[model samples]
Target chain A: MIEVRHLVKKYGNHTAVSDLSFDIDGGQVYGFLGPNGAGKSTTMNIITGCLAATSGEVRIGGYDIFEQPEKAKKLVGYLPEHPPLYLDMTAEEYLKFVAEAKGVKRSDMKRQIEYVIEVTRLQEMYKRQTKFLSKGYRQRVGVAQALLGEPELIILDEPTVGLDPRQIIEIRDLIKQLGKTHTVVLSSHILSEIRSVCTSAIIIAKGKMIANDTLENLENIYSGDSYVTLRVKASEIEIRRALAPMDAVMGVECTQLQDGVTEAKIDIDSDFRDKVPEQLFYAFASIDRPILHLAEEHATLEDVFLELTSQADISEESADDTEAKDGETV
Target chain B: MTAIFKRELSSYFKGFTGYVYIAFVLFFIGTYSATLNVRGTYPSFEYAIGNMSFIYIIVIPILTMRVFADEKRQKTDQLLYALPVSMGQVVVGKMLAVAVVMVVPAIVSCIYPPILGKFGSVNYASAYGSIIAFFFMGVALASIGVFLSTLTDSQAMSAGMCFLVLLVNYFQTTLVGFLPTSALASFLAITVVILILAVIVWYMTKNLLAAAIFAVVIGGANFIYYSVRPVKYGGLFPDIIGKLSMFSRFDTFIESAFDLTAILYYLTVTALFMFFTVQSLEKRRWS
Candidate 1:
């Protein structure tokens, strides 16, 4: 479990993470979704005790990260954005060093290292120098490092950035496996990855939390009035007249596709979206026009991400405009 | 801490830096041993160690340049900060690792004393005393190098800055003699030194107001002291510089007495620089 309250990180005059707050429960894969420069990495760094927040309180496993860093850090395994590998050291040696640093008992160190190597599937390349390993292998080694000591919380920052598609899937499966036992938090700009892997998602933009909920709930909540696109073998005016009396159809825009074919994009009211498809077919049949195509377009997680981030951008611009006006008045 | 210490020690031996440091120091020791003890027919091993003290200016930078700078450049410091260890432990662990590497050559040089004993009466008291002092002095300089390494992510910059710092410390005794020992001269020199300290503070913290306040307070205090008792200001600058020179303290061990104060001074310098190194690392998180 982790609790971050009003966390803020600033570099001189520029704020990286500003007044951010979030709570993560144990044993679930939580996706940290944000665009570039959205303070995801900064928040991860502060939670892992790798950075000092300007003013905030971060508690991991009931331990304050700043006050009881050693005790708190013992419950965390962090893999930074770059993997943080010692190029000269072998994977086994690096893992052993990490195991010792994480306070793994001498008796269990070998078994624990092997367990992580097995989990990350880095058994064969464990003896190879990390510099000789490819980026995907290096990322696996980084994950193996974080999996050591069996920390209750595993925090990774963009664990599959440069990996190929297969490697990304392997890492996703590994993270899903990790989620079964530990609380896994990973940040990525790719929305589909989050939708596929994470059970819960937190969306942030401009260093602020915009949305936090289960994946299904987020998609449903952001999925407003649905719409249907219909291709009718009728003229634009005739298609419009045919649907003009229908109360279920909220609005319709008819575009002439060819000489005799017309494409009508129908916006259905939320209450009638389901029955409108059947009603649409009968309405065209009665009008003596053939229905060429009928398809429903529902909102996806990608749309949710774009909408939230763009909404944040619009609000930020308005805020800047107000501040500029205030400055002129002063 | 042990994990870091072991890795640091292993890296030194695994790479060329540790071997280069050992060979460089031993080269000086071997040269001085042949010329001073064997060829010159000298009875003191302390003289050989004393003559070879200047080797630290070169050897320490090589040993310590990569300790923190490479970690930073390669972004491995994130691992260090995220680990279940304190910054103090990391710094002290690294300092001890460098100290172990430096002690290897000194320990090997110990064989020379007993070798000289077979032919002539080597004063084992001063010989071994200076050897111990020499080891402590190397650790003291290595601590400065560690602190210098933490200031930058470039290994070349760290090494160059450390070399320049030690060079200044090496010639500080002679440099002090060039200053005028008058009250006005000492007052002006002390003001200049305070201003330099302020500038260094500004460079590190980037707080111009704090640095300005520091300079004004220290400079004002020095001027008041000079006006109140001009005689007290005479020779003050040179005396302070001479006392601060780490190499000058070793002379007492070589020439006359095994000064416990000099040993204490070396230890204090080591502690002071080690503390600075820890603070520097901790500062990175805040900045």
Candidate 2:
């Protein structure tokens, strides 16, 4: 439904989005996953013909955004980071103007507007001016505006950023329902939000795509590395010495408390990750220390998100963004 | 285009802006018409419209201050950009809406002349002619106001800038008389304006080389023309200002002659500024 190729957006000397490319297929919920300042919004703006790329192309359906903007824009619906509501107008008035602007046929305009208002559950608030509505309802109005034309693609930027948890869930459910008929793409820094509706994600960091794959594929790629924790009745040095001879053990770290109860975490390489736990049992037994506790922890999607976004190679911006996100989540 | 035009027109009336603007213009025209035609017993209503021409200083700005500035501040401009409509259509649609708002007062001004016909003989041709010129003059200034509105997101700033622009035109002929009529003085004064133009170009494009080149080419051309025809340089600057003054053209209409060239000039100014407004709207896509 959308193709962005070699897109770059520069604000003076600063590059906001650099050589970013991605393909969005039809009929799936794709999460545009990124931390703040990850260029997700910039890319979306360019694709929707709201902003121009410095030196690349964005095509919607088959029309080039720069060359044939009217045609290209007709294929996509967009709700920018802010709701873009006219606070002076009631929600009903605002939607009617949007419907007219989108060139909805006179015959279908009523049915289409009704369908969106019902789906967004904006019936009660429609009569109220947007300025009187809460932030959550304002966002609903923004979404209803995007849904007016029944465009092929619906692109929303940080749609649930400030909503309450219940409201977030409602919007997510609405998005999932829309996914059944239309190609839906929404951006959010919250991992759980993305996990709620998306089967796949396109993760970007520092104006670059780091990972683009389904949830299962992304988590599976990093699943090979596992953490084995051991709480043993041994000195820290002895615990390390007992595991030092094993080739499958990538590294060992241990801390001793009180007289000599040691807590150790060992990193296991991919090849022997499954069997290394059993092998760890006998390795500590050889040292005459009965194993108190031994458990292997596989990498979850959260771990993969952190590790991928914080990869050392991505550069300066991601470091600050991932650090801020980490401070929030942890 | 029709969708945008209708929305823009209705939006003006939804608030106090439309009613206030219409009432405001009518308030002035009614006072002027009563004093000139009804109380003073003057057969000509052109003098009334001519006397109140100063109304545009406020009227144009009010009609245009929110044209694009409010959209930018509210971020509703994002909807405009993402919509499936060309920028030209958006600009033209908005201009048409503002023009329609101006039409209400012009149409009202037409009634004063015919109403005064009951009291005495009235020259219907000159009276109606002045109304036409008055309306076109407003439209020309409104186009400038629309372009200024596009430059900023602050409505106050946009309105102030537009006020200053029309204010300059309000006293255009007087300001021209203040200029020294010497050949060298005209040359220096014109070059100074060109230098300011160069500065504006540098600010817009951030290209010093391009601005410098433009300054050199245009300034050098003007200097060469002055050197070849030194006699023509005397009072040339004032003549240029007078000819370009939108308000000055209204003077010829008050003299009771329908100057077709003045109408054509108003149309050209309107067209030029409308084009500039479209270009200004298109400029955001690049930045």
What fraction of the true Cα-Cα contacts (under 8 Å, chains A to B) does candidate 1 also have? 0.89
Q: On residues B1-287, what C-alpha lDDT tens digit does candidate 1 reach at each position?
A: 99999999988988898889889889999999999989999878899889889988988898889999999999999999999999999998888899999889989988898999999998888888999999999999999999999999999999999999999999999999898999888888889899999999998788999999999998898888888999998899899999999999999988847899989999999999998998899989888
How high is the DockQ of candidate 1?
A: 0.81
Report i-RMS for every model. Answer: 0.6, 0.9
Native contacts recovered, in order, as a fraction for each? 0.89, 0.80
Which of the CAPRI classes, incorrect, acceptable, medium or high, describes model 1?
A: high
Segments in model 1 whose C-alpha atoms lie over 4 Å from true places: A228-296, B191-228
lDDT of 1 at A204: 92
Model 2 agreement with the true structure over A1-330: per-residue lDDT tens digits: 888899889998989888888888888899998888888898889889989888988889989999999888888999999999988889998998888888899899899989999999999989998999999999999999999988989999999988999999899999999989889999988998888888789998878888888887887796767788889999888887888888888888888766678888888886787788778888887779988888887787788888888882456667788999999999
Candidate 2 TM-score over all chains jointly: 0.86
What TM-score does chain A reach in every model? 0.86, 0.77
| Candidate 2 DockQ vs. native | 0.65
